[model samples]
Target chain A: MNNRNVILVIGAFVVHLLLQVLVFKDIVMFNVAFCFIYVGFLLLLPFEMNNMALVVIGFIAGITVDIFYDSLGIHASATVFMMFIRGQWVKLITPRGGYEVGAAPTIKAMGFQWFSGYVLPLLFLHQFVLFFVEASGFGLFFFTISKVLSSTIFTFIVLVLGQYLFYTKKASA
Target chain B: MRRLLLFLLRHRAFLLFLFLEIICGWLIVQNNSYQSATFFNSSNSIAANILSVSNDVTSYFSLRTENKDLAQEIARLQAKLDEKPKEVILVDSTTNIAEIDTLEESRYEFQTAEVINNSTRRFNNYLTIDKGSVDGVLPNMGVVGGGGVVGKIKYTSNHYSVVTSLLHADFYISSKVKDKINLCSTKWDHLDPSYASLLFVPKHINLQVGDTVVTSGFNSIYPEDVPIGVVSTVQIPEEATFFNAKIKLVNDFSRLSYVHIVQNLMRNEKDSLESLIQPENE
Candidate 1:
């Protein structure tokens, strides 16, 4: 919205991408699970941002990770799919009171239960599309599903921990 | 017309999503288009540089193992050299020494390279070597490592080349069982990096475990008699006419660090001469 918020968003994008490319890119657990915490950049964007903008941001983030992973457009396709469905997901999980204007749907703003409910499905969807696209196109069926499930859980844990460690609750709320 | 335009304007976001998704799908599935896709793959200069630097750091950890492999190779060569020299006596009085020497010239040139980037996890694996077109490396050259045949060069940038490893799904090499007339083709199943399958072996040929497979030299790409693997399993279905043979690869692909690209000097000549051979009457 404002100059400060735009700067903050850009800063977060760079930090998330750096960590993804430099750190998380190589973090394959037991040769099964991969942690993709960079999806947090899209998950935490301010509410009411245009869906088109969300998709573009998701594309940029996905491609950034892809450049390092050497998996062209696999992550981008999954990220775009998740962002395309994010609007419906938000409406489905909306609280009775509804989200406040200009507030990000983050753990600090939306509370632990709301944030988990909001993030879990989107995260799973992203990982599912990613691993399946990667596996079905190039690997076996059952092996890919296992990779998808394990990577989803791994990514979820990292995103939850990241939210708690980085964002604090609003004091005046 | 206005209504149609308004509908398109309203669903433009969805249209954009579909458009971008199509591009993504194209990139994922059509990664085999090598000419226009160097930038997206690891063969690009920036990606290759980063991988090379990382390899430099990791290569130190394997220095001891590499030394052992090098020692074993030298010992093998030394043993071959120490064997009794068998001189061929020129019985033909008309044959000159100069002409005979020219016939013995080498047909293949080799250049060493380091494996800067390699992967064994994917169905179609590729290796990036530090040597490229600038270093006399070219597409279609055969690569070999510590044990035996590795792969063939797929593409080459200025300073880097991408090798489609033998473990890739599409890689197949013509081989023969050592000391036998049996010829077969070998291919990886993408299930295990260390094992591959031997096809087209006749049912009449009795196969035993640990029979070595080597290049047949029928293909211009690889030299003859380069050891490829050894037979690990042989299965004969009750009514089948061919033997299903499993081979354990000689090269440890997962630990590959160094390789040599075989630059065949007579490839063009051989190919042209072979292409001129036509069927008798058909």
Candidate 2:
């Protein structure tokens, strides 16, 4: 809603997309970098972000991944599903004191323990939804489970890396 | 009504997200058209041309071996020529041999076109041969090379004819195992190139390893006794009434070099027979 928050989400979204297209595409080894880009959607949403904005962001995020992966829109479905579940997740994670004003989510904002708790659950959700959609299309349980597990591990690693690079305490949450 | 409108306004973003996702999913499904886009695959043509050029460049270095092989073939043919009976040459002039002219035309009565494009990886593997309508290639003709059976013509342009290779799951050649007298059709398993499967062979038939498999004269498309492959493994499940055998293909398409396409003078009659018989079953 504010200029800083809009710039933050939009900037992260664009860079997240370009990295998936340009950088992650070239890295062929473990496919870790691709899972991280999807984290941008989860990470950019504010503590008390609007449900509508979260859903919109989720669709954009999934479509961004969809364009590069060339997989017939599996990411979009999963990403929207993740957005729908994020509200309940926030309600659980948010303290009685509630979210601080004008502070974007980070280790400093929610503390390392709380942040990990937040990320791990949503990462699992996103990875599970995506892996299942793709695997369901193929009708293979082995492939689906392997994909979800591998993607979750990769997503966690990328999410941690994303936190390191982007999260900096401006005014101290 | 005002409350409903307010509820709709409140949930607009979720609705939009679903709409966008459905649109994107639909777009992706639409993009995956079954028929190959002629324009999209025109780039594949360029890639095929580049690949042919690249092969030509490397093949030029192998010219000595190629020439040696060609000369060896010529010498072998020449040796066979020596054994020909005297009256056979006289009778040839009185027959269809007189109608054919030109060095290229005389050799095989067909062009030895380079297989510029071929894919043996799909369920229905189609081959794109460099020979086309202009090169005297036509629909319903047969293509063969180092391997016994190559494919049949599917689509043709001025300079290319897409062939349905025997490796295609969609490929069903009316064939039989030579010497074994096992009458059945043959098709590839879509997994391996060095292997194919024989279908409709009755369980009562005797199959043996090293038994030569060839085209049955039942199909006019291919000359009888053309080698398809040998039965490597035969399986007859107790519940199954028909026998299925795995065949070891003689020609490995992965290493295809030169191919010989066969054109029958009476393809139309046989073609109609197949088409007429095809619908009767279904």
Give candidate 1 misplaced runs (Cα > 4 Å): A1-27, A37-48, A64-70, A100-120, A135-139, A158-173, B33-37, B87-105, B277-282
lDDT of candidate 2 over B1-282, digit per residue (tens): 999999989878667767766875675454343323232221234434543564565556556755665676578669868875552445466554533234432323445877654544333445556776788876667887664678777556666566667875446888887756647888886556789888888887787777777888566667667788888998788899888788898776754556777876655665787798887788
* lDDT (Cα, 0-100) at B221 in candidate 2: 67
User: What local lDDT score does residue B121 receive in model 2, on the 0 to 100 scale?
Assistant: 35
Candidate 1 on B17-87: residue-level lDDT in tens? 99889989888777655534356666678878877887888789899999999999899888867762333
Worst 10 residues of 1 chain B by lDDT: B96-105
Per-model TM values vs. the true structure: 0.83, 0.52
Score candidate 2 by TM-score against the native. 0.52
Q: List the residue pairs that clash in candidate 1.
A: none
- Among the numbered candidates, top TM-score falls to 1
Number of the top candidate by DockQ? Answer: 1
How many angstroms is residue A110 displaced in model 2 relative to the true structure, after the best TM-score fit?
A: 2.1
Q: Fnat of each prediction?
A: 0.53, 0.18
